[model samples]
Target: MLEALGLSTVNESVYRAMLTHPALDVAGLAAHLDLDPAQVHAALDVLADLALVRLDDTDGTARAVRPQTGLAALLAKVEADIAVRQQQIEAVRAAIADIAVTHEQHEVVLRLEGIDAVRDRLAELARTATTECLSFSPGGAQPADTLHAEAPLNAAALDRGVRIRNVYQDSFRNDPATLAHARRMATLGSESRTVPTLPMRLIIVDRSIALTPIDPREPRLGALELRSPGLVAGLLALFDQVWQQGSPFGEVPGARAGELTPQERALLQLFADGHTDESAARQLGISARSVQRLMNALTERLQASSRFQAGVEASRRGWI
Candidate 1:
């Protein structure tokens, strides 16, 4: 391998022979190395360029430089070249990182089709998350199949010391099985809270990636996976706000001492806060017709003829 240092076999052989036989002329060096005279001359020319040999102007003879000086200098040059290449590689890597950040923040949102795809993505996110996994599990009691599927994933994240915080609707408190499951998860180092309602089902991991349903009304339609930092940050803030307002998932209260159900109170507040029937139904994860039917029943229960009277009666009863 002196080839790597720009020396051919002929050049290296001539140089080594010349070093050992300083008194040998070109013709004698050729015989020593078993090379033709022209080949020896060509090797001498290359060796001189590599600083492996020097020309004596007085006698026009070529002499070999000491290996320690000549080889060391060539090695130093190789090292310098490597150092430059490393710097170039590092610069390219930095540029790629910047572009990747931009792409993740501005352009990446993947649509996951089918229940299996959604579960697969959730599994991946849970596996990789290192800091936090926050979720809003809306609607009423979770089905047995859902609890079964989610248990292992939640346990894995907790075992890895990743904080898992979940918010469920207050209606879940009325379901014994769901409440028990929530308590069990809490015992395993997960935090669970219940609100009157949730805007949608959402899961955010490490505040860097989020997944939500393509249609809030139909989770069966699958999910939309988001990596955009701005969108994820907004969803993260929403989770924090709702989580702060929720009651811990323990010792389920009886719809506020049997007067108004948690859902009724939330619906009243929604209406008073200027939400339309459709919007209120969306927040409650029900249909608009359901909101209207519920209101009609409320009016009849309060002995009121209209929504205005219902509102007034509800306020008088401290139900709003």
Candidate 2:
């Protein structure tokens, strides 16, 4: 009964002992239960704090202990606490059930607040996925413990012959734990890749469902889950476009471009000739707006942060 009430084994024993005997000191109580005196005193202290027992003055000799005046009342309080917690759990479960039941009408996007909720939803998606799985995950997010919770779902999907393709940022390539995960996924026939960088987190399943972050920094508030085939197809098209230009799995994405933009060519030429953005703007007979536009486009296109790095990449691709 004490265990059912969430009491530890030692706590259960101590509480039971307190109920049976009254006004006994720690040593006397320990002798009765064949437990160490110190252990008995610690248990009594804990029980006292819990309001399950009280210290009784034994004529200035020893501080004996006894069950609280209203022992039954304490039990009722514990019962009430358990009941309230159970109700809360049931309410959350009901909410999730409602979300699923209402899915036929809408995409059922959720704005969850906590990391645990995000992890749980991701795990659910991975588990429920029937066919292909695509993930575009960036760095600095996702907890270390996330892999353990998601591993079973991933393995089960692989068992069912799911074609899983996961893309990580280049930074993840050197992470020992991530590498181990990639190897394990590969062993299960899932293809994993590391790109130079990804703008945000993305997950698409079977070309039927897609999820992406609206604001990568505030993932919970910014997440968008699409279930419509049209929206899914659009997201998949975007994924394919990036994947076609991205480097292969386990390969370093160092200065490689499977395709190049005309703006990128001009940007690289001007940058290589030691021209500033203003100079490039003048040389191209375009305004600074056009130059800045080209720079920003290159950033998105190559997933590069600065002009120098973009130039290096363009040169490596023989675009210069």
Q: What TM-score, computed on C-alpha atoms, does each candidate reach?
A: 0.56, 0.47
| Candidate 1 lDDT | 0.81
Error of model 1, residue 306, in angstroms: 6.2
Q: List the residue pairs that clash in candidate 2.
A: none
What would the per-residue lDDT of candidate 2 be over residues 1-320, giving only the tens digit for each residue? Answer: 56553355776686776667655556677888889876765565345444565433454222323444445565787789889999999997996676566565574554545656666777788778888989887662345686777677888999988889887655565567877787787888888765544657788977887777746666655455667576578788878876776656666555434665443565566666546678666444456776788677875666654443455455566777
Candidate 2 weakest lDDT stretch, 10 residues: 55-64
Name the weakest run of 10 consecutive residues (lDDT summed) in model 1.
249-258
The residue pairs found clashing in candidate 1 are none
Best by TM-score: 1
> Candidate 2 local accuracy as lDDT?
0.65
Kindly list the per-residue Cα lDDT of model 1 for residues 54-95, writing each as its tens digit: 756577466789999998997898899899999999997995
Model 2 alpha-carbon drift over 4 Å, by segment: 1-108, 140-142, 220-222, 254-320
